[model samples]
Target: MATLILAQKATSLAYGPLVYAHYLQDHESDLTVTVEWQDVPEITVGGDKTNVVLRIGDIQVVGAANAVHELAIMSGHASQYTDVADQLPHWLDFTRNELASGDFKQLGQTFETLNRHLTLRSFLAGYTPTEADFAVWGALRANKIFGGNMKSGGAKLGPHLVRWFTYLNGLPCVAEALKGHQRAVESTRNRVDQGNFDIPLKDGALGKVVTRFPPEPSGYLHIGHAKAALLNQYFAQKYDGQLILRFDDTNPSKEKMEFEQSIVEDLRLLGVAADRTTHTSDYFDQLYQYALQLIEDGLAYVDDTDNATMREERGAGIASRRRDETVAENQRRFEEMTRGTDYGLTCCLRAKMSVDNPNKAMRDPVVYRCNVKDPHHIHGYKWKVYPTYDFACPVVDSLEGVTHALRTNEYRDRNPQYEWFFDALKIRPVHIWDFSRLNFVYTLLSKRKLQQLVDEGLVNGWDDPRFPTVRGIRRRGLTIEALKQYILMQGASQNILLLEWDKLWALNKKVIDPVAPRHTAITEQNLCVVNVLDCPALPEARDVPKHKKNPAVGIKKLYTSNTLCLEAEDAAELAVDEEITLMDWGNMIVKRVQRDPATNIVTQVDLALHLDGDVKKTKKKLTWLSMLTPAEEPGLVQCMLVDYDHLLTKKKLEEGDQWQDYVNPVTEFKTRALGDSNLHDLRQGDIIQLERRGYYICDRPSTTESPMVYLIRVPDGKAKSTAAKVNAPPNA
Candidate 1:
């Protein structure tokens, strides 16, 4: 267990660390912390004494900031404390230098800055709280002047600050920390409960609740499958129960070992570890016996109705001709099916639940089908007849001791049929809970459609950036953390919603923005060369932070020379003597412009350094790369920046609409660009930002075989103009 030593009469500066430690102990099961009070004297304002000390085994940390950092690291939650890793030290310094000042005017100014920062964001660093919040909140709570101001309506402290403070203060951990070893007070604030994420199961018991994720091993797991798997894992962990990963591999013609392996790998990537893995085929013999029992009990019959007529009969609420077949004859046909006889190849076993039930799903649903051609991937021709998902699911779930069957609402109509099997077999029944299916507008979640796209070469493969598979989105720059957080936020809402892609990508932006390294790339097409008249004769190089707000992301070498390259679009908008800011560099004035007289394309321009000019006053902020100097030429790295559009043009397809008719004619787009020298060091999968452009992931690095580096654009969940666009051809 981790131990935290604090002064008996701790000061406000130590409360943040105390609260953070308590939070870890409560939320992180692996980390157990015991706080020990000591008789150490409280440090004065300018004293050089540590108020908080944390010890984990042999690791010891002194001071409030270090203690929080140590606890976060020990609990495997350092990311929460370092979301703004680059600027954390600067913010920590602000808490010490400004907020700790005795002057009331200086303290007010500090609060004003913090209030404005919180205006558009919930936390100081990222979407979630960081060490900056912990330190700042502690400093503010310690100040008597700030406390008095908040008590007196907080008019002078600013409303945003007050709102943020109240929210943080109400948290259970924070409340407990303030009470100093006392029990936490229950929150009384009324919040708009959008939907309950923590869904409680009927008769759910700790260590006994069991859940299962049954995926058909026909294709790669898509985002929809991801939601189901995650929810099952979430419930299982919530109840301290076992989670089973079961593959519904009854359809051998479509299922494959490769797909099953991929599903396992994807689940592992999503942080879902099943307690046990099994296949529906593992109980084939048992299922066959169950079917025989149903036939003997006259609960099921053999039907030879053709595919078209069977659908027509079910739709018209008409009984099949074989509905009254004798039990002995049905038993003979089922035995023939198991033996792969040609006569039984055309027959299927159906449950005789209803002839004209209001619910069409109960109208003699097919329970067993004959497949004599393709050998089972696992069983390998051991049996010719296979039980349908409807017959196999409930039996296997009960056999595996699953207590709750969490499934998508699309199966809600068949819930009764599922329970019917349990009653017909006189076995244990599993509770059924239906949550809405995850559907994205303009996206296809059907495995058959996705496979068609691959077979026709419409996409690279399952991992194509345009596809919605788990691997596809990850390649497209969607972090696993962002995906999990987004899904959990949706929870188990019963109301089905056709969600837009922007909301998910927007959540991803919050995760990657703070850490993605920054670089510069100028479009190679119609590029204009600019001569900086006042530039130094020789090239100058300086090391600058890759991410402005995050110094911990490290630095990149930026070079400046007399000649620079600029995108023609920015040049065309410039007027004679117009002032513009050159991104990382200082402001410059456009002195001259030269264009191709025939096409009006920008060809060449002249600029003069205006370092003293106010960058805020400049209307245009452009990205430029230095080309050459009097000493030597440092050529820019060549890159192919690729972007994509939705696979389908339509936002939402209707029931009868042919999806192929709505397929986007030009979903893939490419643009040639010249990037900064720093891009040359980028390896595959490195996510970086091209200044004035959006984020991108390195798909391929420059090699002897392929000279140009390949970078795929990452969506920023912004308007079309701000993200990657399809202004050029596929190979441009």
Candidate 2:
């Protein structure tokens, strides 16, 4: 049980702890908290405010989710809570310290601070709403004006902020805590009245949760794209809904049929099934009509403003010269654009929503633009103009009867402009749910930069093992189950993060370790031959389990003979007469030492079988392949092994840094190896473990020109030497 006492006048400051405490209480956790309001004092000692103090069985906490978080940690859900320091930079202090300064202009700057932070996040502190969220929303709820605006949805206060604000305010504890604050309830009255935006269901009607996964087929799908695709599938299945695969191929300049086909194939590999497939270009005529109607209603106009001048005017909030163009002029210019005329190519249709609008997205934004450069993949030269995402998304979503629209919050700002189309077109509005886009450290997912790499030959191609594209990583040996698990774990987290590749591959290792077939691959350079003095005169074959844990995988023959080969590194580690276990063949004592002194390379070794010695007692267990073949033995498979390092040296690419400067000079490593004969039958894309080495993917089976098999290195949660080391002599 806990006791919470806050200044009655500053109950708003107590929002987080009070709400969190109430939440645990309602969950029937062995948790009870009694909250009482008191008078706030001007001075707080040691930064502990008496107005918002919590006593959890004698442990006193001052602010944030301190009490609740400590309890969560104790309950074994440590990752569920985050540090309160992160919440300090939020709107809570802005409204208290800055807004209270009586400078109304400060609100804009405050919103900007919170807005930038929210650009890729749904919560204030972490993936889930922390105590910081509850506190901020609570304080905002107390300010009758902000609270009232927060509930209305798409508040000018900040769309991202409002999105999070409404969601948090709707939680059971939040709803219960704000009971006395009528404005908050009334403002958010529309939220519940309409329905939960997160889980949209038709009102007084029956229908599946129809959703869509829209991708602009400009480039191959990368690792970051998997989250969006997987989440859509997850929600659709959870609700027994239909997921539509829609190609937002509005930009003909970049769209291609090849890319479109590759996207479909990629999703198939990821195991994403769609109930229906669609192309935005299919609704070209409808979008054109919507644009005409908007122009006819004086809600849009044709702008001849050049790109540079238009950007300058927009930044300065100055109206474009054509803002007041006649509807006839707009219609004519629009027709000319459709015909691919010179005048049409220079002009674009812009929404006449506002010139001095506070929200920049609503400030007469571009709706239709001429794209006479490249033909649409599906429509050829039939249409010369294309509708921007801002205009096409809402219109198509409504026409297709989409119940929910899930997208990256990077587009959060343009949301108002999106819904405005539906309202103006008098169509049903689809619920918008934005999740943060995925990003990785030392990697760029931008298609333009990726294309630059291809053009400059910085990497092999789209499927370069170093690239993050689905094909690239698959080539690098990422299993489907691993990709699925990674996506599911990060589902709907609005926090935009630049994560390390370590955790991702760490999860991948868990999926592969138990089932991966174990095989042996010895390095070719400086390969050492061993003379087994007491070896069998006549070669004999013994079968060994492919995977020790699961014998059901079957077995392979371990050929034995008087002659054998061992890796130079293993041979170098042996001391004359030192006993070592020749794995699967009992112990052997090294008798003779052979080396090329100039390079310190071991040439050969003479070993006498130590059958009586305890195999466990040996320090090193070396894997050796017999050189003499059995009667029906097929020779070991020759293969090329490939590995990679981060393409960029910089951890995070900043705006000022030239990316080329950070390009890692050496990022790929290759070595020749001899694999077990079983590798000869394995097809491309098979993943296997090389004992004492690393996991590898078969990039190419033995072919006509390249008689040797090709394998790519797979990260198995182990640190590896850099690409530069591959150039050095073996074991240097």
Candidate 3:
């Protein structure tokens, strides 16, 4: 067990003696910690209350809680400073007092009170890692000797707290004893966070890569987006190439500033910071100039055709009335476009391409449309015309010094137009690589479809866990490593294939399995009760390797009571008197089963835990929570489990399908769990696997203290589980 040493001067002040606690843990080969103490108090020996209080006041400078929980733990008292802290002090005080009095149940209630509604890395302070934050983490662990917010309180702060603890523990000489422990880890496949990979290409082949993830700021990122971001980041990093992140903010009607901010954050969370972030709006001037150049060269013209006329012209290869205008007149009309007079639905600049081309995208595509009323996100409406992507992308690529234009095959027919724009403008050429866009079997990756879901309120906003945006994926707990692996594994190939969602989930599991801490929880459901019947008093279990291969992550399990809850499903499968292995705990036999008839829910499960001789029996295996486990016995716990499905039901979504009709009714499920108090320390972006369930991310914390609602990545497509060992992508 790690030892904590406290140095203090005793006093009878209203808040008790001022004390400073220092946590000490050896930097053994198996553990590591580094702590930096800022502004340590100079030597001050004071027996009087006033003198000690002044010293404590100085300590506060180094220790303002970074967030609510952290602030409360350090200085919250019942009478005087209650208002300065959050509202949960009564519960926390009660729990702390009870734990002091050896009342385990009340202690659990206290943790629940303080833990409820806390957010992960949700900083109340200006920056992170404040003294209050560390103090609260330490207090929670200390207060945890009583029990935690698992049952009586519906919160589970253990995993998040533990993760936070681990991170802080690595902060450069954290705990004096744990200074060098993390440095001795077995593997350090650290990846580049910036730059593009410089891959050598053969003649006539694209050599340098210039990949861009053009996200329209319509909504927050989703999980699928994380995959794309990481993929682009990985290729750029591996080949020493440039990765450009462009905001495809063509449709300003739905885009928002919040989404723009979130996109930056999502990329940061994925660990691949873009080298250069460009906006589609940035090229408006050049795009307009190119359009004018096109008109002068007889390569484009003004199209006054209304929507219906333009539609028919595009459909039947019918030339619009203005297509026959003289080149000088067309150029004059284009100049009029820049003057912002002919605005809105009536006027547009169309490429003067063949009306009878085999490829429809080549038939007089509208290069610029007038938007007079729309206010630009960055630049307020200074001009009226906006460039279409087909025209703007290649133009911007040339101007931005982009080398290879990588896009999905959906733009295959538009490549010629891309080339045309480059040639007509007399700009340097850009190579194009058309790979098949990612298509998940049960999910939609279409930006248009996703936008509809956001607009129609079919799900919670853009970052809704069901969405495939990168922010959504990070919120769903999918790791950057997993996403990078999955994306690159697709290998910049042109072949189109529908990837199974299970593969995505499986990859996530592998990436998370190694480093995520192990925790345990039993839900409110009866079958998942925690009752320790045969375990020895004060049992000791190794803090399981957070990642079996990475020694830097180590989490000790928390155990309590004599009874634990099992999942209702697992309870149903257990036959009375049948034997099963209890995960890492060997084997056990079902002694009895109880159910609530009205709810048809399992009320309780009684198991005769097998010890010693019968541990090797192979009849079956099970995962059980032990009530006999003490506060120090770390274990895993059940939490709110959420599962997501695609919003659209059909394979190829119809233009007008009601997105709400296809909404998966069952998107989230709640279950009580038992895991280590360590979970409470997890940071906002940490990714880990919850045993039996898929991988999850520590999303923003919820009420009830435990970072509620771990973003889960359940299988989306049906793939039969196989015994075949799957090989992870390289560096995953």
Candidate 4:
């Protein structure tokens, strides 16, 4: 067995070799590796100041980068890809010289170069990972500058770079290595108290507590479902227990395999992994037998009550006429229903828990219903009758060994009904824990309503930014870290408060603000031209940091010339001979202003350079872009900026109110703008700030076929203007 020795306190520099070794152990069955931690100051076997040492038989390697190279060669990974093997030393040299030298300008340039290189490739070299990838990834991971930029939601990193980094980090080998190191460090610290807000489960024990996230495969998961899934995973992991992902596919009319697969993918995106997976249909036979057992015990009966009358009777606390039916007759009716006979189509199996209980949910709820129309997505047309959620949940929960049933408080009234199943069937009882349902103002959590919106073309699709679905918000720039942080901050509060979207978005802002690269854009409509009286005769290109606060984000080129363009609104606000500061340049005095006599819109302005003027004394610090000559056309990239409003005009839609009536007539607003030439290089899903125009995410990049680049405005947690202001043409 090969042994790898690492420092007791391993730094990020040690992650590369550790991950590589773990990967080899997982993938190569014949290879056995053991890892040991030592309290040595440093390993100097190869004259390198590293804490990582790898020994194989009589040969030893020192330093993380060196160990990775040696291991790749020894493991035969290098010889397989001889083309990429030569590039390993180049990346190693770059890591040692450029990355380790602490040169911000060179670091920024290197990040941009690497980002462009990864645009079309999965790894640094070839199709599979190589020593080049391991060395570069390790050095970047250990570098504080790269780590900080990534920590801020990768707002500073290019989209392709972020994607590549995320893919590597998500690998099981890499994740496990990092997590093991984190656990080792955390083990030395005192356990922090959760304070008074911690909700404890009855009879909960370490490794014994089992929680399940049961999502019906009727529609894509919304934010509400995300909360439930996360909370269940939280409790299960908190107690070192297991989490089971159970698909409650009881309603054949609505459930589909597509929805089931999407739910699974969404859960994975949310970092909620289940130890086991199951479906309610898995217990169909068992649940049917249990229902028959209840019938034999006189605890359930078959009812032929019409849907309307049954609902009215339940609301009025009235009993069904067949409540006194005999067990034999009920059994025969249930069998007929299972066979999908004519009379059976009208009948349903109802638990005899109660008929006139104050809690309506306990009023002999229907346990089994006939669904002869639509076949089950998975089971097919095997049976015409299917179990309802109320009946299948408790039965499956108990059968699956779920210790604590964590659900929303909306199901509190049904808690008693759920408990009655155990007593009626004489099965083991499971604890019921109810937390508050996540409710957002102006947001519809109902799958039916959201589906209606999609079907009616009220929005783009389920992933529309205006919609509150998990994919929707994510497309709108909500980071998984921000979403998880917000959900955890809410904790186990039972108070069902209607939350505003601002708070959640505010948290997202904090995650993206530090690293989001800054760019410039000016509205094309009513654009004002500015001619400098005394400026450079030729355009000069200067390199500047993309983010003023975060130099590690990289650099962008600024082209300066005598001609500049500003937003019409800014020009309209300026007066002749008034001194104003040009952002990123210097203060300038407005010498002349020209406007259209018809509409009083600023058309053109002339400014004289005032480099010695005090920029702080100017009231307006304006963002301006230099314009190219006639040969370069406009010298700016045309972009379309898209902003959205709430789908529903009303803050809270009440029961009995028509939601369609309150749909906002116009929810999307688009503005035409001219942006810096660098915007043309941006790919889809890149997040950037448009100087004075707030933040935007690239929905579509500019192409030769379509000259306009599409950008969607990202909402900050500030008070927004009304519909008029949002829809109005951009002046500011």
Where does model 4 exceed 4 Å of error?
A: 1-197, 629-635, 721-732
Please give the distance, in angstroms, between residue 316's alpha carbon in candidate 1 and its true position after superposition. Answer: 1.8
Error of 2 at 669 (Å): 0.5
lDDT of 1 by residue, 1-732 (tens): 788777655555577678887777777888888877655465333345667778778876777767776777778876654546877778778876888688988888988998998898888877776767877787787788999998889999888999988887888988777676542211211111123558889999999999999999999999999999999998999999999999999998999999999999999999999999999999998998999999999999999889999999999999999999999999988888778788888899999999899999999999999997898888888888999999999999999999999999999999999999999999999999989889998899999999999999999999999999999998988889988877876788888889877768888889999999999998999999999999886788888999999999999989998899999899899899899999889999889999999999989999999999999988798999998632453357899999888888787999899999988878887899999988878898888988878999999997768769899988887767223233345756
Give lDDT tens digits, candidate 4, residues 1-732.
Answer: 678887755454477788888887777676776777665556566466668888999888777778888777677667878977676788777765776656777788888978998999999888888777777787788778888899878777798888888888888998888776677555432121121236888999999999999999998888888988989998999899999999999999999999999999999999999999999999999999998998999989999999999999999989999998999999999999999999999999999988788999999999999988898999899989898899899999999999999999999999999999988888889999888888987678889999999999999898898888888888887888888877877777777888888878887889888989999999888999999989976887778999999999899878888999999999999999899999988999999999999999989999999989998889999999998633454368998988888888788888899998888777788888999988888888788988988888898898889978999888878778223232444322
Residue pairs in candidate 1 whose N, alpha carbon or C atoms collide under 3 angstroms? 86-551
Candidates 3 and 4, the one with greater lDDT: 4
Cα displacement (angstroms), candidate 2, residue 291, comes to: 0.9
RMSD of each: 16.1, 18.0, 25.5, 19.9
Q: How close is candidate 3 to the true structure, as a TM-score?
A: 0.60
lDDT tens string, model 2, 593-644?
A: 8988898788989999888999888999988887777667777889899878
Q: Scored by CA lDDT, what does every candidate get?
A: 0.86, 0.77, 0.57, 0.85
Backbone clash tally (model 3): 110
lDDT of 3 by residue, 79-186 (tens): 233443453444344323543444666655644544442344442122443333444443443343523442334235454444554465454434432322233221
Write the candidate numbers in order of decreasing lDDT: 1, 4, 2, 3
Instruction: Give the poorly placed runs of model 3, Cα more than 4 Å off.
Output: 1-251, 268-275, 327-332, 342-345, 528-552, 557-612, 618-620, 626-638, 650-665, 671-696, 700-732
